[model samples]
Target: MNLAGRKVLVLGLGDTGLSMAKWLARRGASVRVADTRTGPPRLAELKRSLPSVPANSGPFRDEMFADIDLVAVSPGVPLAEPSVRRALDADIEVVGDIELFAQALPERHARIIAVTGTNGKSTVTSLAGAMARAAGVDCEVAGNIGPAVLDALMRREDAGRAAGLWVLEVSSFQLETTASLAADAATVLNVTEDHLDRYRSIDDYARAKARVFSGDGIQVLNRDDPRSLAMALPGRKTSTFGLDAPRHAEDWGLLERGGEPWLAQGANALLAVREMKLAGLHNAANALAALALCRALGLPLQPLLAALREFKGLPHRVELIGEADGVRWYDDSKGTNVGSTVAALVGLARLDSKLVLIAGGDGKGQDFSPLKEAVARSAREMVLIGRDALLIEAAVAGAGVPIRRAASMDQAVALAAQAARPGDAVLLSPACASFDMFRDYRHRGEVFRLAVERVIDAPKH
Candidate 1:
């Protein structure tokens, strides 16, 4: 782990790349940066913080890989890139920020709780962090959910605070380059088709997520997802969470008490589903996963339950935005893949009413056929938008739900409002990327919220 006088090349200049550069430079590593973009977002900040480090932009140079001892890659930069492949061919040690953070963990004396899956990673990570803090444990949420792991490490070191616990929301992309993150507790919440553009197949994607269980840590898996359950290794300690009743004494699940669902560990009911502030059955599953992860570290159950009861789920993921004409509107712009949209749709299905779904974006090469069953059962109408609207329309064409296309978010919201009945809900859960029409998912959610507000303020006819 000693970097004194070692040469390192930082590939990409995003937040992760910048953090890698800062961390490497502080360890006295001779650092140089190369980014595919002529002007990366963090270029100015890089110049200000570490002016002495050499930075080259636009088309990666072959010479950049020469004389470099290690290549610290940002998750956004694929390993298949020519420059990265060249580095690998040259026998240069290539790693990511997470790997570096893992290698440095011993000095910090912190236990790690790693969470990864195609969906619900952020929700589970946030809730677990909240549970730990409520129980008076000093912990920091990092990785994909907050500041970069290396940035968090530096902040904790500078503050002279003990790194009590680290709750990380890791993505499959990060997992590809990470090797040494031996979390005290880890979970692959679920695995579904996502990032097909980068991976050869769904199996490839799931295998990358499986890396979270590389160490001798307790594995918390989703019983409902066969892919997640299949990750359990022989002789390794395992825990499970699902919407149905728990099959084992130590596992987590839902139970029926007085004709209402309650969160249960084994046959013992802990809290009623109605007591949780977060909406939807999917969130209940997320809450159970968080509880399992926290409890694996032996964190007390009382504070964890307190945190779950008070937690108001993350924004842009099944968040209720407004209500008009007795029709509720939700912003689930964070549903950037088919799995997330399916979860949201199935979780919000109601017997008395249906959903007017606003979906479609980049699609990311996902098979949208999985959405058909949920749409057929839960959605009254589907309003498609963004680049892959036609693809989704075709997928759900035989689902018996009427499909409409819109060129913009505002138009999509209007169409959904028109299609929704008095008791129905409008859900913006695009199972695709937002790059086609918006900067990101948060921007897309904001636009959807504003459009809903406009419709709510329009004078009644």
Candidate 2:
């Protein structure tokens, strides 16, 4: 792990790359950065932040790989890319920010709880941190969700807290480069088909997620997902979370008492499901996963349940925007994969009401067939947008539901509003990445909200 006098190349100048470059430079490694994109908006800031490290912001050159001792790739950059392949062929080590941070944390100041999945990772990570803070513990939440892990480690170090906890939302891409991340507790909430462009197949993608269980740590698994259970390490102490009743002593699940559902650990009821602020079955599973992590880390059950009851849900993941003319509007723009969208569609589906669903974007090489049943059961009408609109439409073809296409978010909202009736829900839960139509998922969510507001504010005839 010694970087002194080594020539290292940090590829892609996003958050991970920037943090890694600065960290490596501080450790006296001769660092250089390269990105295919020419002069990103924050390129000047990246240069200012890592003044000692030279950068190549344009196309990557083969000469850049020459004599490089190591290559640190950002998650956004595909590992199978030519530059990374060249590094491999040259026998130069290629790692990621997560690997660097993991190597640096052998005697870590903070206890770590790392969560990874195709969806709900951010929600679970935030909830775990909130629960810890509620119990009066010093906690920091970072990694894939926001601030870089190395920076988070630095922040924890600066505070010098004796018992700080780090709740990190790790991604499969990040896990690909990490080998020695020994978390105090870790969980892969659920793994489904995703990142097909970066991975060779679904099994390959799931294998990347399974890395979270590599270290000797308490593993929290999802009993409902076969892929999650398949990834469990042999002989590790494991706890599980699922919608069904818990069959094991350490598992978490829902139990019915007095005709009401309660979040339970084995047979013991921790909190009534009615008290939770988060809506839908998917969120209930997220809460269970978070609670399992809390238990593994020995956080107080009472405080964690209290935090779960009061915690407002994260934005853009089944977030309720508003209601107008008796129709509810929801923004689930973070449903950037098939599994996520199916969760939203099925979890929010009601026998008494209908859903006007707005979906479609970059398919990311995912098969959309899984969404058919959920869409058919809930959607009164489907409004499509973005690059893979036709692909999604064809996947759910002939469900007896009316389908329409929109040129823009504004038009989509108008059409959805027109199609929606009283007691219906207008949901924007595109099961694909937002890069096709917008800057990112957050941007897509914001635009949807603005469109809804415009429709809400317009005078009704």
Best by lDDT: 1
Global lDDT scores for all candidate models: 0.93, 0.88
lDDT digits (tens) for residues 1-461 of candidate 1? 89889999999999999999999999999999999898899999999999999899999889878888999999999999988898888788999999999998988778999999999999999999999999999999999987999999999889989769999999999999999999999999999998899999989999999999988999999999999999999999999999999999999999999999999999999999989888789999999999999999999999999999999999998999988788999999999999999999988884228999999999988899999999999999999998899999888889999999999988998899889999998999999999999999999999999999999999987
| Shift of residue 66 alpha carbon in model 1, Å | 0.9
In candidate 2, what are the lDDT values of residues 1-461, reduced to their tens digit? 89898999989887788888878887789988888888754578777887767888788889998778989999888778887887788788889888888787776566789999998999999999999999888888889998998777766666775447878889999999888888999999898888898889989999999898777889999999998987777789999999899998789999999888789999998887778888777888999999999889888889998899999899999998989899989999999999999988877784228999999999999999998888889889999999999999999997878999998999999999999999999999999999988999999999999999999999999
Kindly state the number of residue pairs that clash in model 1. 0
Please state the error at residue 160 of candidate 1 in Å.
0.6
TM-score of each: 0.99, 0.96
Q: What clash pairs does model 2 have? A: none
After TM-score superposition, the amount by which residue 325's alpha carbon in candidate 1 deviates from its true location, in angstroms, is 2.1
